[model samples]
Target: MAAHTAIARPPLVPEIPLHLATEITPIWQATEAWLGEQGIEPPFWAFAWPGSQALARWVLDEPGLVAGKRVLDFAAGGGLAAIAAARAGAAMAEAAEIDPLAHAATRLNARLNGVTVVEAPGDVVGSPCRWDTILAGDVCYEAPMTNHILPWLRRLAAEGAAVILADPGRAYLPGAGLREVARYAVPVTRELEDREERVVTLFRVLP
Candidate 1:
């Protein structure tokens, strides 16, 4: 068996409560704990994706929105959004990520949150399973990935799934019919940095 070593971490700071409370924390202490336990470094998006925490925080604060809904958290990294959705009374919650490493981290975080997350990436095209709502956080920063995801999201909407996105005014978030439901001024740091770092808006994909 491989030897395990405890990783020391700085004490976590208090996170401010956003609109959605029971659903998520602005700073995901559970994800932090899970990452420490696994001793795995995070992927680029986890660090680079702007407005991720803000989105998760907002989702956590709004349980009524997700209540009784079947939710799919696409490209979930630390499973923050999925966890929040589950706590918000979503009938079903699942997470999907392209990277196997992210899937592992998502599962670890999910377990930390006392929830279950399906750890696999499925076809963006013609999904066999149906979901009432699809949650996407910080997925519109990259041009290529945005190009790939937007069409599929449109298709999902056409198929009767509601798509919600959390974006920090990224270049790609515009041109989509995403109406801003909530907004927050999230504190950012250069320590764990992002390209266009700052506060962001959480928007719901309108039909």
Candidate 2:
């Protein structure tokens, strides 16, 4: 890994530890430059983002929410939520990421945490619901990404899947058609989010 290694305990989700970058900016820049050289997207897998941390924490705490259910961690960077679901007694915990490097990172992190999460192929938008639960974290950071994913997620929710989104006050988050289930104050590296603490909200997509 290009990042300086450290045992990171994310805010609001301390039980699920992660091998995260000790210094955010250097590794972030290094990974970005390296990916650019290879003509790849940003290496978001190098860190345990705050929203993912909160979702993992919430799932671990409320094991009944996912116990014996099939779970899908969408855009699962580092597979934190997927690992938590597996550990929380989900029948199957799968992570789907478009970036190969991020997918590999998810597998590595899952192993470190003593769990197994299958990797799904290709972009999952428009795919029929194959799991009982869907978890999306910090996915609304960009308008294009949110626009592309929100409608599909809404459709899944309408189909009776438990679709949950963890957002850190993104500009594009929907104002309606969702209900807040929980919230957490997640501590994060300022270099990554320009703030030390982020208040993330976990919402259940309503049909």
The TM-score values for the models, in the order shown, are 0.72, 0.92
Alpha-carbon lDDT, every model: 0.61, 0.85
lDDT of 1 by residue, 1-207 (tens): 001111111111123111211212222344456456543434432332445566566656777777898988887765667767876778988888765656655665556567766655754444654888888877887798788887777777777887888786677775857777877766555555343246677777765
For residues 1-207, could you state the per-residue lDDT of candidate 2 as single tens digits? 724556666666777776777775666667767576643455677788878888899999999999999999999987889989999999999998887777877777777788889998579898999889999999998899988999999999999999999999989998899899999889887778898989999999987
Q: Which portions of model 2 miss their true places by more than 4 Å? A: 2-4, 29-40
Task: Give every collision pair in model 1.
Answer: 20-60, 20-61, 20-62, 21-61, 23-60, 24-60
Residue pairs with colliding backbones in model 2 are none
Provide the lowest-lDDT 10-residue window in model 1.
1-10
